[model samples]
Target: MQLIKLCDFRQPFSLNDVGCGYGALLAFLAKRHRGAKVDYLGTDLSQAMIDQAKPSPRPSMRSQFVVTGDIPRVADYSVASGIFNVKLNQPTVRWTLFIQQTLAGMHAASRLGFAVNFLAPPGPDMQAIPELYRVSPDVWASHCERQFGAKVELIEGYGMREFTLLVRR
Candidate 1:
């Protein structure tokens, strides 16, 4: 939810929840932002995930869930959480390219801004996990600033070994 704080809730807005597993964000908004008007669209690549999300209690009549890897329409804001963490056996170069392209897509889909979280590099004492994709925050912050001409804000040290990039256009 902290990642979505980049959005303004004082008025009605539309949101695209990329990789919205089981529509968890919708439930969070339903409970926490009951008075705020939100038109929510949840997208995931897995059909089973969409099926799981469809039966969940909806926050509003405007909410919809779809099985897709891309955002279907422009929205006021877009958010992706824990989407870039697991790389499995994908090579670093390919994974990095995928992240860059996904970020570009998110920037294009969002009108106000977009936010995404990534795992931070492992501590010196901890053995690096090959399956987990982690990097210094500056790598993507610089990309958002230069590639999208966005005003990027890095949110970190919130009691997690991760950081979120809030890219505002």
Candidate 2:
């Protein structure tokens, strides 16, 4: 939804879907941007996801699905949706490292920018949970700005329990 608006779509460009699952985002983009030219690549770590997304790829755009540890090619823009939500018992330090590495990769692989969403930290009245990672938007946005020298924006107040970080290079 909001992730699609992270970059300008009036011109031809490439997009890398980091951690894409089943190509649903690709399909939605293709449908939403019918007249705009786009090159879409969806990368996932799971072979099953790639397999499921390979068939009947979106016809509105040049599309490919790859099972890879990282995006294999540079694109005009990139997005990671719901990738940082699941912590799965991983220590916060280790997961933060993974986020740093992944965001670094995203910055290096995109010519324009990248967008990612993180589950918002629970309120003081609510107890923190272990299975899900609830992070402060400022924490990661500041990290992107400092580490990548990118103009970072935090999009919130959408009535959702999450926020998006739009990093422009």
Candidate 3:
């Protein structure tokens, strides 16, 4: 819900959910924003995920699901939820580069803005894990501002283990 709040839903808009799995977010968005018209396009690398994503029958909304390696079209806003949390044994530097590239792509694919969440680095009482990519908000906020010249908003303190970066073009 916090990630969706980053978008302006006062009017009709299109959304591209990168790495969207099973289209749960699309359903949630449609159900939550009853008055807002939304055209949702969800993309995933796994065909199984795409197959499992049932299209919404809401007359106010239209949806498409695809199994693609990248975003297929531009949208008014894009939100990638829980996409960067898993590193899958990749080196930290390598995963960081992947994140940078993905953010660049998301920025290019969105007309209004984009939001993404990252797992925050564990506190002193928590032990660090190698398979997950826990990133500091400052790192990607600075990157978005520098690379895309975007007005970046760091959304934290939501009682979640992660923080969101809202980059407005």
Candidate 4:
């Protein structure tokens, strides 16, 4: 909440949730922004995930969404609540390109800010790390700032491991 307010994403704002696997954040934001009309859009490469996303309390609470395709070039705020760390079967170059391109999408769309979360990779003793990408926040931020030229302020350990980028407009 503080992050949202700090970024000034009150009601009537537009949020683009990239790689929205289950739309949890979308639903949560919809509920939070219910006081006012906010455009909550979720996009993902997988339709199964969207189908699996739990429904909002009401029809109105549901987040508007589309399957992977051409998305916003720029938006008020771009959210990757739990995306950006997915593992892929492509080569390292492809993986790097995918990350860069996705971030580019957020950069183009976000007018005020872009927020993402990459939980730290489990340790050797951990049982499982279900996520695809598991890079540290600082490493991710380095790549992000290098490409986007945005001033990066990293806030970690708020809940799980999260990365919020207050992109320069």
Give lDDT per model, in order: 0.91, 0.89, 0.89, 0.65
Model 3 TM-score on a 0 to 1 scale = 0.97
Judging by TM-score against the true structure, name the best candidate.
Answer: 3
| Superposed Cα deviation of residue 118, candidate 1 (Å) | 0.2
Tens-digit lDDT track for model 1 on 16-87? 999999988988888787777888999999988888885325445279899999899999999999999999
Error of 1 at 82 (Å): 0.7
Off by over 4 Å in 3: none
Q: Return the top candidate by lDDT.
A: 1
User: Which pairs of residues have clashing backbones in candidate 3?
Assistant: none
Q: Per TM-score, what order, best first?
A: 3, 1, 2, 4
In the order shown, the candidates' Cα RMSDs to the true structure are 1.4, 1.6, 0.9, 3.6
lDDT tens per residue, model 2, 1-169: 8787776877888999999989988778767777767788899999998888853334547888899988899999999999999989999899999999999999999999999999999987889788999988989999999999999988987998899999998
TM-scores for all predictions: 0.95, 0.94, 0.97, 0.74
Candidate 2: residue 71 lDDT (0-100) = 80
User: How much RMSD separates candidate 4 from the native structure?
Assistant: 3.6
26 Cα displacement, candidate 1 (Å): 0.6
Residue 154 of model 1: what lDDT?
Answer: 96
Question: Candidate 1: how many backbone clashes?
Answer: 0
